[model samples]
Target: MANESVTLRQIARKVGVSVGTVSRALAGENGVSDRRAHAIQDLAKQMGYRPQPLRRQRAGAIAVLVGTSESGHPDEDWSQRLIVLATRASAELSWHVHLEFVSRNDDSRRAVAVPTVVRENRVDGVLLAGDPHSSIIEYLHRHEIPMAMVGGRAEKTGCVCVNPDREQAVRTAIHRLFELGHRCFGVVLSDRRYPSTEAFYQNCRQSLADHGIELSPRQVLENLQPNLGGGVIAARRYLAAGEPLPTAMLFTNDWMALGAMMTLLEAGFRVPRDVSIIGQDNLPWCNQMEPALCSMDNREERMVREALVWLRRRIEGSPCEPHDVTVHSELVWRGSCGPAPRGSAPNGAGPNGAGVTSPAPAKSRQADPSSISLASPPGAS
Candidate 1:
């Protein structure tokens, strides 16, 4: 008889255990005790028994759950990018990707509904692309569904997460600005509450403190949206405060940074001349702007790859320790940032020609925006 054709029932008969126990042991399921599972697996391997391939076990479909805003509108830019990356990665693994959008309102009573894929049992695993509500995550956990969170956190739900290293990104941005002769810094933040945003704020504060810098309350702008209109409001508020402006500013993302730049230019503040600014996401328009925006490039490809690997393991019934995976962010240098303005510093220079001490100049290079795909679906903003 062929060794690969050895049956689990034959192994169970030899091991004096039920066929179900032997099957769980060979499949790496948790029903069987560790001692019995190991013994059965060893005997099966000795007998040259081969478990069935994963492809034959079930349908090869994965679901991606995207969340809509409180107003029930989809965020095309972020969501589209996430979906594109996920689809690209899934293709390599021979898995189909399906997108499901969950819209929620302010009322907690009306929670986010379960995804249709889960209801229909069409997908083997799920990838959460955004902040789908806690209730949704809880439902998945209760049902014992294999799921991983991408670009978001689900620690409370015990779901593995793959996201950008926001703390490291903030530190890199601050260090780069410091080397460029910027001391005082301002930060623009969106009002939306998410784990990554919270991580950004905490890391920014810690990084500034590490440099013996104090982040003043006036320097932090919060509760603003993450759009062009929010950027306009932030600029107006900063200008009307009548307080001394920081030499460097960091916007949470590119859209708000572009909006703030436009508003500042209209008000006669020359970008990187009067003030240096940086943004995150390294979007396509970063290079098209008159003064190209310097931003952080969040490695979406790597994030997707890691998330898919974890999800694949879960779907294949492979034993994997749940852990968070974080992809580092790279600083994409462009034309937006420059040396701080003369005489704008509160303290005189320490023989460095400015208020802040400048370190030895490091080699800098401009990033090729063409290297990254910024294309979106038709009508996508």
Candidate 2:
């Protein structure tokens, strides 16, 4: 039997399981337990049960349609990461990722090209990677093209979306800062030029309020773009405003956080001493910084792979349930935050020999003021 060709039905019968279970186990379905699925796959391999290759359908290739031009937002690393992940995922699915890069310079070709690509059946489904404008999303919805968003939940349509729950991420960051004895809070937000981009900015406000951290209107600044330069400009303006500087200033993304660090160091502020800063999207560079960045890891690659799996299930016309998958982000702590000023911890954090043993609650903070400051004296590391 090991050398002989065997049908799936035979494998199912021999294994004493349903054909459907054997098929799903082969295809890696969600409901199939890993132990049973792996057993089925192993037994099938032992029996030399090779699946027959089905005819490739039009839905096999999923095109990833990006709304923004690479040139338009050069500093945003998230977009490039998403595209690379999507491409890799396509290869895993035995499908091609057709990138329909809509050039911003050619504004007129925008609406026409995407719909044309869909109608022509060039790909089985579409993955909208970047900030999709309302018009493009509307067109995708109108055409009934099987699609999903690689960003946040789609505002206009019910297309499948994969995103890190930003609200949870933001709340976690604030909770950590508060544990570290941070009272005043400041947030740098992305400008609301596109609809989907508003998710980060809006969620920050809600998270702060929920965490009991009240920030004045003047403390929150919105940069025109979501990039390094925007962060530098916003951080500079916030520091110069002369109002009591926030103990910690949270940024929208890692690139911005790096930029903010540069500005703060230039102004002679020691991190976690004079000001604690937190950023979202823990890109590779986050760890390379001198103090190392305290940021949230979005887990983009995993999210992309999961999104492809969902889109594939939908395209295959399988009884795949429609759902939103939100990946959780964990806080990556570093030298950026210091122990709160003396006597800040309400519960009196436990003491471990290496450092203070704070309960790794969903969020952690240090209450002592002597241990932390908002500004380090000039020329001090």
Candidate 3:
């Protein structure tokens, strides 16, 4: 009878909000607008509604972690970009921010630890840039720290994980490649430990299988180093392997694509004609490539901005349940991607002619930190 003495719907109706809003506001979670949240809260108390007591506290600072190599360099250029964007967003919102770099071994190593600010519960919440180690994720949850991740898929971490749709992006890329008549395929990848990267890789292979093209083991190059140099090596390995080159290649990110694309050109393999390429992250440098690399627009900036807003709302007490959100990405067609070479359907061959043996010109650049130019490219039907 006490529980039914007054209901959320009654409180919500009196304050002109959904019962959901009243629940969130009362529980001190994020979702409702500031003014409405306060009004709903005030009305609930006035209506003699008794809700469970909440012990949530706000420390006024947010911890932003960027997963990096033990040497301190980010795993991908996008990781570095996340730190810059997070810092700017915090500043613009006048939020106190704590920045930390974590070694890739964090999930397993005893030496790497969560930052002191987070350990002592000194921050309102934590914002992870890319994929931090699972141990780091565990520590946050153990402390009951509210969290929102920008890029990586931290599944079941009990936090808000948002990003461009990785599975859909792969499906979109395959659809476009299929439309252009591509069959046999190659790939450049990072370790599948990252949920986002894993999603993209698994779906790419599956999508191709749907069209009857089985991706070959020999053609898949796992990039140990996620930089341009790693990309270059992967491309070289693809060339040296006795396997015939496929007509299209896919990369987990733009960095791998840039290095591999340039290497292919130097090796006398014309892109799209000899081999087509598509990569993720829709980076600005994709436009500068000799043949403007084809890429998926992952909408990084929007994810970063939305994550901050999420943290702020949870800190200030808004009223909506946090759920994972996937934004759509449009495959931007460019010069680097073209139809399969005539007669190259199921797969193709090495170096076109016997006499071709030398290097060639290459090109690229990252976006400036001062700009937030990542917009969701329009989705194709």
Report every candidate's CA lDDT. 0.72, 0.65, 0.69
**lDDT value, candidate 2, whole model:** 0.65
lDDT of 3 at 12: 80
Give the TM-score of each candidate: 0.73, 0.67, 0.71
Please provide, for model 1 over 1-381, each residue's C-alpha lDDT reduced to its tens digit, 9 standing for 90 to 100: 237578878999999989977865654444677678778877876887764333436678888888777424566466778888899999999999878887532345333456656655678888886677665675566445688877666455477888788777788778777766677777888854766677777778788777767677777898787788777888778777766556788887888887787777666566777678888889877886667889988887888889888988888888766677899888887778887777555433333222332211112323333322233545867
Which candidate tops TM-score?
Answer: 1
Q: Candidate 2, residues 79-156: lDDT per residue as tens digits?
A: 777888888878987997777654332333223234444545667778876655544565455434577777646444
Candidate 3, residues 1-381: lDDT per residue as tens digits?
Answer: 234367888998888778877866654445666567668767766776754223245566789987776625665688777888888888898778888887553444332456767765667888986566666776565344678887665456567777777677678778887777666677778876766667777887888777666666766777357777877888888777655566678887888877887777676667766678888788877776557788988887787888888877766767546578777777887878887766552332234321111212223423222221233445834
Better of 1 and 3 by lDDT: 1
The residue-level lDDT of candidate 3 at 170 comes to 77
State in Å the error of residue 144, model 3. 2.5
Worst 10-residue lDDT window, candidate 3: 353-362
Worst-scoring 10-residue span by lDDT in model 1: 354-363
The root-mean-square deviation over C-alpha atoms between each candidate and the true structure, in angstroms, is 12.2, 16.9, 13.7
